[model samples]
Target: MNCKFLAIAVAVILFCRPGHAQTGATVLDDFKPSSLNQPGQEYPQVNSQGYVRFRIEAPKAQSVVVSLGLGGTRGGTPLTKGTDSIWTGTTAGPMEEGFHYYHVTIDGGVFNDPGALNFYG
Candidate 1:
């Protein structure tokens, strides 16, 4: 009886271990407007984990994508068009802390985010 109890305890400990018990990734809902955003703009937000989210309004646009993702090598983060004609998307993974430059591509036309402040170097 003692051996059976010990085996059960060991199994429970292993099953309850951190990282092993989680069934899926957790993305925090707490996000705020980016510091670089233009006044009154709510999009181009960043989360605590460095995940950036964008919301653009282009009612007739065919496709919208942000030029920021996976160290800027994996094309970019593609935004999905919602029923309201808004394009929104979040980065696949957390980005490195600090400033990063990006642009928006709408229907094959590249353009800067109108909501964000422009940065020139």
Candidate 2:
């Protein structure tokens, strides 16, 4: 019957739609290097949505972390090392729009981000 064919068509259309049903807010693809970055630096960038992304390079380091605007029990966004020996990660959520102090933790030692301009805080 036409009803049966119509039902099948509707099911196919629903199933073939692009992307799975998402239950989360979408992050816009608008990110740029922060104004506080050192000349020609690009790692410490901020997006229009206020999310912060960090990238650090340390080949011999066991672990790397950014003590920035991350909000959780861990207190920071942990960077995962890639094959290129650079560590990178993004904040779980958007950060407040303003100046904030942060540092990198490499193998349990705190160090300033070379890409970012250092503030004597």
Cα lDDT tens digits for candidate 2, 48-117: 8788899999999998889996546876999989999989888877776889989899999999999999
For every candidate in turn, the CA RMSD to the true structure comes to 12.0, 13.7
Looking at model 1, residue 51 earns an lDDT score of 83
Model 1 accuracy (lDDT, Cα): 0.86
Runs in model 1 deviating more than 4 A are 1-24, 71-74
Q: How close is candidate 1 to the true structure, as a TM-score?
A: 0.76
Predicted structure with the largest lDDT when compared to the true one: 1
Report lDDT (CA) for all predictions. 0.86, 0.85
